[model samples]
Target: MPSYTYPVAAPNRTLTTEEIHILLTNTRVLARRLADLTQMRFVADYLLSGRFDATGGGIFYETGEEIFAADAPEAVAPGSEYPKTVLTAGELASARTVKWGIETDITDEKIAQQGQVVVDRALARLANTVIRHVDATAWGVIASKVTSTEASAAWTTPGAALEAIVRVQEERAALGTGLDLSTVVLAPAQYAKVLAMLVDADALPRNDSNPVLDGTLPLRAFGLEWVTSPHVTGTDPWLIDRAQLGGMADQTLGSPGYVSASGVGIETLSNRHKDDKYEVRARRVTVPVVTEPMAGVRITGTGL
Candidate 1:
């Protein structure tokens, strides 16, 4: 019973002013690095995906008319002049880029107790917000410009899910513009239901068995790459012709107009708030437009 008293644990100490400055600087750098990568199950970038740079805050697009030939190529006689063709150019249109942003504050006391780990977590939340905002905004444009809607059998129906897509493909083919619907964005609930049906029907086979799919980042079936998002507000899945859907314009990083995967621009700013806290401001400057509304279609009646 004569054991020595246990040593008291060292108490945590508050970080110094200089230490806080260093922390803020590191966080800013982290934000810059995060900017290079942004693509994450976001349907906006995949659907309205003609990513390009804006010269003067506005993107000029052609609402091109889908011109179709009235007849097959006529066999031209050796000396006869080629048949004259008259064309009406598509009307010119423009969409302006609107800046979208979100921000948060990190208090000195919180960081003093929690360290930079908390700061990193907060930065992550900021990035997520920016990306999600881009998607939501893009979806808003799509919903507003939908050209057509088709009723679909619920995915639970063994053969109906695949058939619905085929029907849609047929409709697009009828447009005579070669609108190839290569991607589909599903509501989370519909996505889950489809995956279950695929497994039950042995379309998504087990690894041990002869795999029908490669188990890749983009889950594919029904002749299109499928993705799920919480932002896809309804049960209907959206089918899009990526090549002709529309375009998303963003502010250029430098002299070049190329934007990265996220179709977003992320900027992180930090400054000490009179020695009490640091504020981080993150933003994306971009706009989405359904320049070719007919290039996409929404499949409805998924639950039915």
Candidate 2:
């Protein structure tokens, strides 16, 4: 029988202050890259500073108020008419912290092999988790707004999706709010489907030199800024009047404190096991709210 000898364990090596700084710096760079991947910054207006007060009030315009025309009379009527406005008080319903972290045992072998790469990957993952949470929260708020429907069939044609969006715009117009529908956000599959339709119909002007086709500019279709987000799944796409959608964040901590266009906070904690293990963490706090539900519409049943 052959006897097998156990491999010796590697010794633990303490990281120097300079090495620690480099790890943190690299981690921050990775976090920023992950933050750039988030989609909320393109669709929702964000307020980075202000405490979320549950007692805060919201203003709502009463719908269907009639406008009367005055006849040219010898005597001017002293009566004044004004649209009814209601102050609906409500608190910010969503306020929470999201966090992601990782712990790794520091081994001499790992240090020799540039173990900081592990921390860099962890920080990148954490940043992505935090940013995605913020985006999901924003989408949740937007989804809660008014919803409209299209024909219960898959949009197989290019202009078909545009028609669905136009219906939402028409609804806003019918409300007489004079809000311009400026933004359309859809799932990636839907966007690709619509783009193909446009291409097939020859409706989209094409130029090999065009920045939009070359990916230098954003894709704009039918006078609406087109945005694709994975957060929007299934058959529901959103049409929004930018003026009516607003969001704010408390700045008491800092500009976007926990969450921002840049990235979230990353911290390192020394473990009690004689530096045998250490923890790396990322965290963010944010609350996204829809200020005017009437200004946006969710289109469902696209069958995409």
Candidate 3:
């Protein structure tokens, strides 16, 4: 077997910190690292499935006590016609659909010096920014529409978090919304506590074979899996029935010549001869709304 883990020739000289400092940004590792956030777009789409194809500037929905009321069938005489119920229109609500975009310029000289990877990197960076914004917008809408419920001391206290989660689950069942809240979006602090709680309960083995010891949290509890978002956080975590929570809308078509990306609106690249640079622009027109208020409940004060 090779001694330094890999076969080996010994180093001719020591790799001093002084020499490493010179090439730190470009080598030894990638010069840049993107944000490593938990993937939550699926969660967004699941909770907000109202996607429309039009790039129209406005979106309208109806809401009210009557529209949202759960109605049950009433029995009548076998041969009689069902009693007529007066139809009442719910209040109309409208939201403006907004366009979000980003643009950057790349010069030929920079491309020559740094290669096309530089341009690709710029595109990737800007694209991720747009995606992050989209998620943030959707999460913000959900957070704002949530019904605030009981607080919990789960973060620092063992056995306290599960009770809070159960209580909200019960409260939601009591509402008779006909939909069950299936997921909880937790914060990092609360998640750590849960890992400990699992080990304490003997649900996870306390050994090297345990996933937790290897820096992983593999767990399911109360018939639901927890979710976490860097953007969607506070003292309150959301418990939502993704299928009934809300929706999002965005425009699909672009002007005659612009390029298109899936789920993103329009993108265009053009050579700016006069300026000696290339311009890259992207736009995503989207709107998110919470139509069913009863579909989500906030687990308040858990981070505390």
Candidate 4:
């Protein structure tokens, strides 16, 4: 009692409300950038959900036959009725959760200033992992559903590539499905090769009047919109009707407050405890399906 005074405890300097806002903003921006870097999100339809549903279905019309009428005197029988076909998506056997967490020690002094950096790193990791899953799913759908694979060693030439795409279009037309092959998605290397060949052939239109040249490759030669993706893997290119691709996301999973609670779908969260540690997490439930196998064509063995 006569001797010593207790040392004053240091005041807690945890991140303030403003700093938290900044950290979240930065994390969101980084996450969006990662999404933009990958083509899967852009090419495939994206769905957001609050809940997960295992089964989904879509409907299509069967091709109707044309009846040729004989002379006016001859009676023509009515064409048989065509029934609508139903395609049910396979059950979503599983949901993928991509998440990351960060912890800062209690003694750390730069939590406010460096919080954004920590959050950014975690978000970047989450974004990349999610994109990889999405790309893999899309690739699988294309591989399993494409009507045919056109192998070619002539992809280096614009004419050859054009011919390959045209072949797909012709096949689809022959099926009389009326599914327009409007999008051409190629692996990065193949896209570059095609671009060079097109430039050499002067197939790209000139727009000297515009100060900025369009970096997008022109696909008018094949009557398609060109989309290049690193995710397309291998030497194959996919010609597809975008409408036939199915994508679903659990809306509730990615909601703003999902991190704290656990339910279904995608969610993100962050928190700090009395121990002076920080944490973050992300989760999602999604799947991609191909409603029509004949709506896509895969051109392979391009020798790229």
Those runs of model 3 whose alpha carbons end farther than 4 Å from true positions after fitting are 1-46, 53-55, 64-72, 87-89, 153-160, 188-221, 263-274
Clash count list over all predictions: 0, 5, 1, 10
In candidate 2, where is summed lDDT lowest over 10 consecutive residues?
Answer: 1-10
Q: lDDT of each structure? A: 0.67, 0.50, 0.57, 0.50
lDDT of 1: 0.67
- After aligning candidate 4 to the native by TM-score, how far in Å is the CA of 244 from where it should be? 1.5
**If scored against the real structure, what TM-score would every candidate get?**
0.78, 0.60, 0.69, 0.61
Preferred candidate (TM-score higher): 2 or 3 = 3
lDDT by residue for model 3 (81-121), tens = 87666666756877777777787876767665665455546
TM-score of 2: 0.60
Can you rank all candidates by TM-score, best first? 1, 3, 4, 2
Which residue pairs of candidate 4 clash?
48-251, 49-250, 49-251, 49-252, 50-251, 50-252, 253-265, 253-266, 253-267, 254-266
> Over the stretch 61-151, how does candidate 1's per-residue lDDT look in tens digits?
7775656754446779999988766565567888888877677888878887877556656766777788798888888888777758988
lDDT of 4 by residue, 1-304 (tens): 0111112222255546466554444535323433332222323332111122433322222221222222234344588554443444433333332232222232123455575444445554554455566556657656765656666556767777777778768876886677777777777788777777777887766763211253433244445566665667677777777665444433333355444222112244555445655455555444554545666677777766
Q: Give the best candidate by lDDT.
A: 1
293 in model 2: Cα distance from truth in Å? 1.1
Q: List all candidate RMSDs to the true structure.
A: 10.4, 11.7, 10.2, 13.4
Name the better of 1 and 2 by TM-score: 1
